[model samples]
Target: MVKIDRRWKQVVRENSQSPLFICLGEKHEVHLFETYFKYQLREDARTNDVYLIHYQDFTDPLTYGESLLAEWAEAFKSWPQGTAAWPGVDFTVTTGTDAGRPVAALAELCRLYPHLAEQHIFVQIAPTVVSDFDALRNWISDWGRAVKKGGISKLKLVLTDHHKHQTYKKAADAVRFRIETDLTAMMQHAAEFTNPKKGDPEADYQQQILIASNQLSKGNYNLAVAALEKAVRIARRQKLPEAEVTARLMLAQCLAAEGKTAPAHSEYQLAITAAGEKNLVAAQIHMNYGSFLLSQSEQAKAKTYFSKAVDIAEQIGNDFIAMECTRLLGQLSEGILTGDAEAIRYYERCLEIAREMEPEKRRQSSMPYVAGILLKKYGEKSAAGKILDEEMRTLFGENWIDLTKKPKQMK
Candidate 1:
């Protein structure tokens, strides 16, 4: 199973004060329960005060009240009235019979022992209650209303049900559950959030774009396309310019990956126009377009776009992108224009810039172009040959020598 790391704990703790809804599958309930208990214990340790209210059996309300009243009386010597203890901490237990009657019970508790209700921390355990879709919605709405009006600091509702229903799943803020017996499969399912709903549609659309990009990274092209399409529709509906541009770019990449060249080219053009000038997206647009043009044997047009990308990258002080653009330009000019000395010069410049940069993936990516330029300059026969050989080995491992086949038409 994937371990819940410190970062996950931080996220949950930060949101602890807020209303939390949870739905747990049977297999995972124990894990969720343990985590929840840990959170409470942590908070209590920090605050130096903790109160727990058990609601499993409430056969007699008077008996429950007497126990709570005695506890409160001992905590505060003389019971104060009204809103004096409004911000203090108090945990009150309630049963399934009290699930729909939270407000009424709260009012009764307040009238009888005003201090306890003034500083209420409700721990409602409704084991026998069977909540439908409407009940779930109403429960959440009521919880929100109580917090807004009554200034309730914490409200914890624990439901003991055999089957996990969609209603509870949708209402819960974050679910804490365990995975099944297969740890790998459990971890995978745990990684997927049950709720994808966002408060704002535009924000949700942007999230979809990110999800699509992640899917693309995993080589799930069809899923990526579907996500991108949904993101585009949402962006259009919300009139979010940045999101629309991003969706277009992602769609273009998906199309290119699928080898749908004509449509991909059209999409790239749209992305370039939508991204406009003086933006990171615009720089990427130029680079992608240049790559496409180069693949189609339009070296001159591709060179112009690559140069534009280089300029933009320089303006933004993005040395990696500048190096890549410069390298690509050199490749295009050399491959299609046949040993163009100017292309060799550009490649040399890229190498110089790359040498100054930190060691990273981009630095590694630039090595091939540097080797290509050396091959162009020294005719694969001089000291340049030794440099190329060493670089290929360094970049592509020992098999590099076997894989170093010359391009059929190195114009």
Candidate 2:
């Protein structure tokens, strides 16, 4: 083990929970513009709480060492780092090539804190640092002496407006990190919050929702359910009511697909209670529940939910849901409604909406096909023909599809 100096040890103990940053350079120049660095960092700290340690140069090494240690001790004297259940972010941005103790210090930080590999970042804003191959390589390898084995994340190569970082640019890209000339917006994020503020919980919940959505769409039901459980916890902890409703709805759908009826129904009830009827949320949940009921052969119960979906969709003027509910209602009418009038009315309503719909929405798949068959079966050829004509126009160019020449089985 490379023993840390007693001064650095105090810093490690006191400030480990806050993200640690070290600016590396030719010793004097880095500390020369320390004022400007402090100005920019102070502005950033308003949004993020970073425990920044800017390298200071004193006239005497003895005074510099004493002052630096005192500064750290004073800063965290009362603030507890607590037990390291969640070791916070570790970040670094080097401006000059100090291929000495500063580099070795980084190696030590990375070795002791494995989370550094995930959160530690390097921003090459100045040319002198990456101008020398030896210095650049040391940075790329995190000073080539991590006890956990040497490695580093992508180096952010900030180009001068005159584009003087061509060498660094090519090298960074060659190593698989595409160079970014603008680091202002990204600077605060790399130095992200130590706690779960700065919208991290919401961001994590959103990411999980995206993953769960794609997994569900791809029929990976089990994985989707697992992802949704995480999303639900994050949403609840963050006190995000809308996001919780969305996560629970998808969670219920996944459970229903997996045939976990009891749990699926429980999730549905929770979501529906949170999102009362007459809202779009209610419309969506009811439609999903109705589909689940249909899949389980509870057609009578399914129709009730589908009817509720139609009412909510109409109240909110959401034609998309209206179209789905109407189509399903028409299909269910044949088996349960005791008369063909309800079926004809549902099909006619679908056709009316389909006519007003833009061709791109492509409502033809449900309205035109179902309406044509049902109206014709009831010997209402003229009404069915008009709906069929609109379908042909919507699905194909007006002159492309002619129902008259279609085979009997097609009608």
> Which candidate leads in lDDT?
1
Scored against the true structure, residue 313 in model 2 reaches a CA lDDT of: 91
Off by over 4 Å in 2: 1-199, 210-226, 336-339, 358-365, 378-411
The alpha-carbon deviation from the true structure for residue 307 of candidate 1, after best TM-score superposition, in angstroms, is 1.3
lDDT per residue as tens, model 1, 1-411 = 124334334434566555443424443443544454445534344332233333333344324334344444454454343434522334353431213244434444455564554442434333223335454444544544554455444444433232445445555443343222333234334334443353568556756766686677568899889889898888778876677777987798788879897888888787777777876878877887887777777889888988998888888777877887887777677655375787878877886776666666543455555666566576766787777667667856756544434323211
- State the lDDT of candidate 2 residue by residue for 254-316, as single tens digits: 887788988988897787777777888898888887887787788998889888988999898
391 Cα displacement, candidate 1 (Å): 14
List TM-score per model, in order: 0.42, 0.44
Residue-level lDDT for 198 in candidate 2 = 62
Clashing pairs in 2: none
- How far residue 129's Cα lies from its native spot in candidate 2, in Å, is 49
